[model samples]
Structures are given as C-alpha cells and as structure tokens.
Target: MAWLFSLSAECGTQTQAELFLAYFQKLSWTLQDGKTITTVPEVMEDNDGNWWCMVVPQGLSENSVKSDEDTPQMREIGNLLYASLWNAPDFRYALLGIEVDLFRTLSELLEDTTIGEQPSNFAGLVLAESIWDLINRPETFQIFKPGYVWIPYPD
Candidate 1:
C-alpha cells in the first residue's frame, strides 16, 4: 500500500496524478445486469509505470476497451496496436505504451497467459479463471482491489 503512493511520487507527474485521483474520487456505481464487478473505472498508468486515477465510465472493462470500437478505418489503424508482451521481441516498447495510456500490444497480452491462445500453465489458467471469477463475484475483496502493480524500469 505504501508502495502505491511512494512509487507514484518517485516516478509520476504530480499534476497528472492529482487530476486522475480527482476523477477517481467521483465515480458513482450501481450493480448492472447482475454481472460480477470487481473493476473500478479510474486507473491509468503513465509511461513511467506509475499508476494514476483517471475517470473512465463504469461501463468500461479490459475487454470492452480492448475491443476495436472505432470506425473501420480507425479500427484497421488500431489493429496495428496488436502485439504481445511476453512473446514479442519488443516488450519494452509495449511497456512504454502502457505507461502512456495507449492500447496494449498483443505481445504484451501474451504476458497474461490467461487471455492468450492455449495458455501453457496453471498461472495462465489461474488468471483466466480470475477474469470469470471477477465477473461472477464482482463485490468480492479477492477481486476488486485497486489497480496497482509494479513494473520495473526498463533496463
């Protein structure tokens, strides 16, 4: 928990962090359609890997936001956003995009084996299992913690 703020202070833009925090403080929620709901709609990471709170709609989810929702041309352009973190040679660049509020590359998605094709181990299976678990039991503490995970500075 201390790491959450300490890292934010050491690595983040204060103004941007504050702006996002203000936004996160304002969300209003209701249980919709009885889906599981552990997600909060107000976290973003800077290119520096510091987490900030940005107000996204409660309706947004990783799946929803990750989808190609733009016009066909835009979607096509966005498809270039494809790449994975674990499998790509350029995981560093993908990490940079994550820091900048950009779409994560598929190569990066490969990091979370749970979401990728034919995950090879229990870890990946566990992650995939958690996704469904969150949907089914949104209010569970096991699911709805704030989004704060550390990514080391690139070597």
Candidate 2:
C-alpha cells in the first residue's frame, strides 16, 4: 500500500501556497522540452481532510539511475537528483496534480527548513548520504522495487 504524508495545517492558507510557489520558482528547473515551468497547481484537500499535493520528482523515474550501483558517489548523486527534482515545480505538479505548497507545509511541520534549498555541490554528497540514511532503512520504508524503497510518512 502507498502511504501518503499529511500536512499539519488544516486548510493551508494562500500565503503558504504562495511561499511554496516562490520556493519552487527559485529552483529554475527546465522540462525535457527545454522550457521553464512557471506555475504549479493549487493545493487540495485529501480524503482525510488534510492538505496535500503530489509530485513525481525527477530522479524518481524508472530511468533515473541504476539502482544496482551501490557506490558512495552514485548514492550521493541519486539523493541530489531526487532533491532537485522533488523541488521542481513541473515535476511536483505533474506527479501530485497540486504544487510545492504541500511540501513546504510538510517541511515546516517537520522542522526541515532546508528541504527546498539547492544544495552546494560539496553539500550535495552529504545531503545524499543523509537522505539514504533516512529512506534506505527497512523500518521506515516500503518496498517499491528491487532497489527502490518508498519512505512512508507517519499518520
């Protein structure tokens, strides 16, 4: 079963939505067509009355990276790529049918302010390592594929 992360906010405010949009715009991501995405879909309420959005961050795709490669460098690249695409407006909107607002709200609730920031090349590796530690563990993850794991959010 897929686990959905719920935002702490009841019905996210417009201000929150705008902030998420701004954060995504700052990332300056480009689509495969080489066009920059300028907008994201609005936030919506889920079945459980929590605000949420879906995003298929870039590196999550089946072709993103070979999961068999277990090198430190490869793992770092995967994390960085996932983070980058996760914050992209297009990717977020396309996957979730909403926008980055859900992510921003979740980040605030989780006290992870740096979730949207672009990591420096040096820091990317470290961030990747940290990300792996968080999601690669079996206790917190659902088996999505042979080499891929999905981190389930707490209810």
Candidate 3:
C-alpha cells in the first residue's frame, strides 16, 4: 500500500499555497521524483479548486506498497510540516481559512518513535494547541479525518 499524508487547507488561493510551499521548503524535507530524492514537494491545484500538498515516497504507487520502511517516517514528517505552516508570520494575514485536516494511512507506524516521533508529533500538536491558545473564538480548524489520500490524476 502506498503510504501518503495529505494536508488540505481552505485557503482557496495559489498565493497561500505558494507561501505554504515556501515555508515547507525551508524545512529541508526530502522530496522524491521517480527514484530521485528532492528538497521540494510537488504542489498543484486540483479541478475542484483545492490546493494539495502531498508527500509521496518513491517506489510506492497510488494503492500499492513497494516499501514499508519509510512509511511511518514520511507520515510523521508530513504531519509536522503541515502543522508548521500555521506558525509562519504571514499565515494569520494571508486570508487563508483556518480549516485544515490531516489524513494518513499508517496508524501502526505512528506508534514508533525511532525517528524522533515524539518531537515531530509534539511540535505539530504544540502548533495546533497554539491556534486555540492565541484565539479565543470557537474551533474553526481541525486535523481530524484519517485514511484519506489525495492522489494526483495523470493528464
């Protein structure tokens, strides 16, 4: 099974997506193109006008697993990077909506902390908690809804 994590934000603007991509690039995560590992994630807009930020490991297809060694690590890293966007200074003023959700398929892998799992999840949770801490309004953002992957369709 292909291991994937998707972060969907209702910002509805390519500008916001670009900003998020910039922030994500600064973190220096390893992105993969075919068998090559890159430093930037591939970002694009879907037909429904939603921007998708995806992390797809090499050797894995849309619905098949080619390797399991890196699935957990990828999911955790994806989660961390997804949450860190909210910490950007421009984030609050970007006119981006606050509704975000994290979808993943490796629940079992999340239990392993070999690759700094606690810190990753904790950092993400801290950012998430800060959302509620700084704002006194009702909850408008959420990271719920699991097991959903956004696969890009080939043209």
Please report, in order, the local distance difference test score of every candidate based on alpha carbons. 0.28, 0.32, 0.36
Q: In candidate 3, residue 73 scores what lDDT?
A: 48
Candidate 2 overall lDDT versus native: 0.32
Between candidates 1 and 2, the one scoring higher on TM-score is: 2
Model 1's alpha-carbon lDDT is 0.28
Residue 23 of model 2, lDDT score: 52
Residue 151 lDDT in candidate 2: 38
Error (Å) of candidate 2 at residue 89 is 13
RMSD of 1: 17.3
In terms of lDDT, the poorest run of 10 residues in model 1 is 1-10
Give the alpha carbon lDDT tens digit for every residue of 12-102 in model 3: 3568667656655555434443333223434566555655443332332432234666565455444444445546423221111112232
Regarding lDDT, does 2 or 3 come out ahead? 3
Candidate 1 TM-score, true structure as reference: 0.21
**TM-score of each candidate?**
0.21, 0.28, 0.37
Question: Best to worst by TM-score, what's the order?
Answer: 3, 2, 1
